[model samples]
Target: MAIVKVDNLSVQFAAKGGIKTAVAGASFALEQGETFSLIGASGCGKSTILRVLAGLQRDWKGDVELMGNRITAGKRFQGALRREVQMVFQDPYASLHPNHTIWRTLAEPLKIHGESEIEARVAEALEQVGLPSEAAKRYPHQLSGGQRQRVAIARALLLRPKILLLDEPTSALDMSVQAEILNLLNRLKQLHGMTYLLVSHDADVIAHMSDRAAFMANGVIERSFDRAALVNGEHRMAHA
Candidate 1:
């Protein structure tokens, strides 16, 4: 079953002199427990699509349905819907609070949702992300790049979200750290039976994590193909 359905989506931004179209007439769907990726060059609207799905980008025209519920445009998700979907951004350093400890970072979401067992959930999330419980005592600056990203992932998973929107999740990390994070993501997906929508410019990363991928350019999806084709370099973008 399709967990995410986006149809005829379009997003425009007010630039210096006029409107800039970021995503135009974009359409796609992600099946439950499947990994779908969007790959393209910089400024090609891949990240914009992810932002829209995460409800961080407003002022757009489109129809977006998550688990059969329509998501109204230009509005932030709230309550149950917000808890159903979570996002892991590209920059772990920028996404996390420098002043807050990892424990506080993970605890805030649980508090917002009025969930009990916040302490246990936070500890479990850290373990699931392969971080020691003591790591939670440190601030973002005290951790390595990979460790920080793990904390970020742990924060997202604390809510038990069914859908994860990853915007270039490992782009800011070193190659070895990227592999570790990718392995963690794969293991977590299998463990939780979660669905993933990933945005990345790295074809190797896409091949490693996605079942299917779409190539986007100039605000529109130009092509899509199976992961195997992408892995073997058999697929080519129309704009390439």
Candidate 2:
């Protein structure tokens, strides 16, 4: 069964003069433990799709199913169900709290869910993301770009999410830093049994990390291809 599924999903916004549709009937499915990527040029609604799937944006029509359970827009699920899906954003700096230490930031989710074993969970999450236990004591600003990104990944892993939505995760970093983050993501997937829905404009990164690639245009999915075909440029296949 598909871990994540979207069918004919459409998203539109009301403009001053007209209605602007950002996503138009996009559909796709991601199986358990599969790494699927959405690739397209900027302003192609790649991030928009991720936002919708993460339940951050409503006002759309479609069926979004995670592990056979339908996700309703603007509805709160149980903490366990909510924890089953986690998102890592494009800018780690912005996503992280400036005032909070890494320990506080990482522990917030567990606290919110009333989990008492925050210390052990935080330590494990840090280790899983290749960070040392000392990382938990530092503020977000004290870390390098790559370290900060790892903390973001660590926080996501704390929940042991079954699916991870990665929105242009490495776009803000340099090539070297980007490579490190990508490698961490791969290792985390293996360690945690997580499925990834990675959204990026970089063809090279998509080719490197994804087993399948989906191309989006004007908020719609145009096609999907196997990873081999994508890296070889066989997946371009004449866009409409």
TM-score of each: 0.96, 0.94
After TM-score superposition, the amount by which residue 124's alpha carbon in candidate 1 deviates from its true location, in angstroms, is 0.3
| TM-score of decoy 1 | 0.96
Candidate 1 Cα RMSD (Å): 1.4
lDDT of 2 by residue, 45-152 (tens): 788888887777767788888888888866765446678988999999999999999999999998987888899999988887888999999999999988899999
lDDT for model 1 comes to 0.90
Off by over 4 Å in 2: 235-240
Residue 156 lDDT, candidate 2, scale 0-100: 81
What TM-score would candidate 2 get against the native? Answer: 0.94
lDDT by residue (tens digit), candidate 1, 87-141:
9999999999999999999999999889999889998999999999999899999
Quantify all predictions' global Cα lDDT against the true fold: 0.90, 0.86
* Model 1: CA > 4 A from native: 236-240
What value does the lDDT take at residue 11 in candidate 1? 97
